[model samples]
Target: MSDFIEQLSPLHTVEREEITKAFREVFALSAGKRVLFWMLEQAAIYQDAFAGEATNSTNYTLGRQSAGRRLIEMLDAVDPRFYPALLIAIADLKTIDLAAAESLAKQQEGEEYDVEA
Candidate 1:
């Protein structure tokens, strides 16, 4: 047997330290629970695919869309504790602009001040 072939094993057991730190910084207890629950749910989908109980394409695609929607909904409200993780996840998300978000927040703050005047 080839050396490379012998190494066929389970997924890499890498510790998600950075991601965990990001999670701690971005979410409160309830939000963190939601994130972890979603993670486990998605992992189960992967497990099903690996076991041939689910299709590769359909389940993966649907799972990803579901996860993304849930994450977006969780992040839609401005919670400072969770904003950093959202920013990290959205770093490469071209559809959402951080600068625009900041500007809109500033505008809203200005409106609130004006209302009080």
Candidate 2:
């Protein structure tokens, strides 16, 4: 549909097949890959929006935060290999502190606060 295409055009750069392959390679899908797939796509969508022409600063910041949140969500659901890649990507979006992810996990586990850099 034209409306659907128009809405999605700015939020996607990679082709569908490429994205599918990326999902397969990164997620390995059997072990909680669905959530990873969803989060990765969400992050990509936000990045795409931020990268689009005529995009405003507000939209860019919103998209970056959306991507960051999705990456954080993926940290909980995805593989260990995913974490550092996500940290870099999140940092590229201007979010600092990969340790926040670890801290959040520890907080959830009711562990004593030991913030690592």
Candidate 3:
């Protein structure tokens, strides 16, 4: 991962350390929970953008593009171990059905809990 880190724009030592620390924290989260959080965050952006009748198509499109960029940034920052879960979450996002995505996440969370028990 050093190669991956080196490819990023240069950062001050403290800034680099902080980023590494943050990544460690994110990496510590259960994979399923991380995927669920990502789904909910994307859903929130869609809900906010489309909440009002006054919202224009342009605004909605911009919101979606912004959310997609953020998702890409998150995928880059996360550990490789989370890739499978992330891919699954991305697939659910493509369905454009927030309720179904949420249900899937909940089901995964339950399965994770059962495995732990």
Query: Which structure among the candidates has the greatest TM-score?
Result: 3
- Give lDDT for model 1: 0.54
Candidate 1 lDDT, 14-99, residue by residue in tens: 23334445655545454554465456456452343342555766577666757655655544433344545545544434345567
lDDT of 3 by residue, 7-102 (tens): 766566568678657765655565644554566466454344554566686586566758766655664565554555655656755665778788
Clashing pairs for model 3 are: none
Candidate order by TM-score, highest to lowest?
3, 2, 1
Each model's TM-score? 0.25, 0.26, 0.37
Candidate 1, which ten residues in sequence have the lowest lDDT sum? Answer: 10-19
Better of 1 and 3 by lDDT: 3
Q: Give me the overall lDDT of model 3.
A: 0.62
Q: Where is model 2 more than 4 Å wrong at Cα?
A: 1-31, 45-53, 57-80, 83-117
Note the Cα lDDT for every prediction shown: 0.54, 0.55, 0.62
On lDDT, the leading prediction is 3
Question: Which ten residues in a row are the worst by lDDT in model 2?
Answer: 28-37
